[model samples]
Target: HSRGSRALNDGRDVVLMDADDFFISENLCSHISMHRDASEDGSKVKSTFFVKFYQKLHAEGWNLTLISRKPEKLRNATIEHLMAEGCGSWSSLIMRLDNQTQMDSQQLFLRQRTVLQKRGFKIIATISSQMEAIPVPC
Candidate 1:
C-alpha cells in the first residue's frame, strides 16, 4: 500500500486500484488463479489477509458476505463457534459465508473481493499476489 503514496496525495489527478483490480487489469489471471484447491491442512492454505481486510472493514463499518465457490471450504461453523467463544459480530459474518469462485487446475480462477455500502455493494478490488497459499481464516 505504501508503494503508491507519493503519487496518491500529490494533488495531481490520481486514481487507485485495490489489490484485486490491479491484478485483472494486468491480465495476470494465473497470478490470481493459483488458489482454487487450497486446503486447511496448512499446505494449501498458507496465510490470509482477512485479518487486515477485516480491520479495514471494521474501521469503515463495511459488513462482508464472502462468496467462495467451494461450499465445502466454508468455515462459517468454526466462525460461529468462535463467536460463541466471544469473537463478536465478526463471528456472525463467518456464519454468512455465501459464495464461491469457479475452479480450474486445482487453483482458483479468480477471487473477487467487494465492498458493501448501505445503498449498494461493488467489487472494490482483486489481488494476484499469491505469494504464499494462505489457508482460509488464517
Candidate 2:
C-alpha cells in the first residue's frame, strides 16, 4: 500500500480529490489574477496575507478546515509551511488517498460536507476556484 493510503487509513480525516484542483495565493486579487500559477502546496508557495486571513477566520471562531489531495510525504511539509506562514493550527487536514486520486472536487466536497455535518459542524459556505463543479442554490 502507498503512503497516501496508509495516511488516510490512519483515521484523522480524508477528503478525496485531485491535487491540481486545490489552489492558494498571496491575496484575493492575486488569487483571481494569477489563478493559473497558484499551488496549494504550502512548501512551494508562501502567502502571509492568506495566513493572516486564515488566522482572522480562526479568531472569529471559524473552524478552518484544509481539504487537500496532497499525499502523506507532503503532510509534514505542508504543516510546517502553514506554521511558518503564521497559521497556528487548523480544525482539520482532510487528505485524499492513492485510490481516491481520480475523485472530483464536487464529490470530495459533498462527502466531507456530510462528514462535517455529522460531526456537528454547520457549514456556512464553501470557497472554491471551480465554481462550475460546486452546486449552487437558485
Candidate 3:
C-alpha cells in the first residue's frame, strides 16, 4: 500500500504520524488541531475525525505511531480521548518524545526502529531543531 494511502487492508499496517501535523494543528483550517488556542468546534471536529479514523484503521489491522513533543502526557490524553469517543481497543501504539535529533533521523533510524520494535515501545530523546540556526516558526 502507498504511504498515507486510503487503501483498505485486513488490519495490521502501521501509520506513522507527526504529532504537530497529524494530531494537532495551530490553525483552524489545519487538519489536526491540538493548539491550546484552537477553536472548540475545530478541535472537536478534528479530534473526532481522527478518533474515528484510527478506529477504522485499527479495526482494519493498522497500527499508529505518534511522534510528539509532549511525551507520555500527550499519549495518555490521546488514548483517553479516543476511549471517550468509543474507541477502546487500540493497542500497540508507539509514542515517543519529539526532539530534533529524532526528527532528523526519522528515516535514518529505520534500522533502530526495527530493533526497538522488539521491545513493544520506547521513548527516544529530543532536542530543538538547529536548521543552520534559522528560527523555526512555532
Candidate 4:
C-alpha cells in the first residue's frame, strides 16, 4: 500500500522500508553482505525482502524496467531451464526469480534508478541500518 510514508529529511530522500527483510541505514544503497553464506531466513534479510516485495509488484500490474550493472536478457523459461540443468550462479539463480535490472555497480544502478524515477515507477531507495550504522556502546 503506502511505501511507508516518505520524508525529505536532511539532504537525501528516505522512506521506511518494508518490514521483515529490508534494513535502512544512513547509506542509501547497501545490501551486499560479506557473509555470503548467510541465509535470507526466507526473506528475513534485506535483499530477499526487496526481491519478494518487487515480485508482488509484478503480480499487481506493475511493469518493472530494471537497470542493473549486470544486465542479463533472458526469459523466465531460460532460468527455469538453467535451474533444471543445475548450472547457475547464486546471483543468476536469485536474479531469475524476478524480472529486474540486476546491476553490479552502485553508480550504474543509481543512474538507471534515477531514470526510472523520471519515467515514473514509484520506486523507493532503502538501505539496511547496520551497514552504515555508527555502533553505540550497548
Please give the range of 10 consecutive residues that has the lowest summed lDDT in model 3.
125-134
Top TM-score model: 2
Q: Write the per-residue lDDT of candidate 3 for residues 56-136, one digit (tens) a residue.
A: 665555455544433444666756644555665643444444543355434423433554456554422211121222222
Candidate structures ordered by TM-score, highest first = 2, 3, 4, 1
Reference-based lDDT, residue 97, model 4: 20
RMSD of each: 12.8, 11.5, 9.5, 12.5
lDDT of 1 by residue, 10-109 (tens): 2222111122211212222233454544342242222234334434543444333432222344354434432442323431231122333334311332
What TM-scores do the predictions have? 0.31, 0.58, 0.43, 0.31
Better-scoring candidate (lDDT), 2 or 3: 2
Q: Among these predicted structures, which one has the highest lDDT?
A: 2
Per residue, candidate 4 scores C-alpha lDDT tens digits across 72-135 of 4444433443234232222111121234444334434444445545754444443222222111
Flag the better candidate by TM-score, 3 or 4. 3
Clashes of 1: 19
lDDT of 2 at 30: 36
lDDT of 1: 0.31
lDDT, each prediction: 0.31, 0.52, 0.45, 0.35
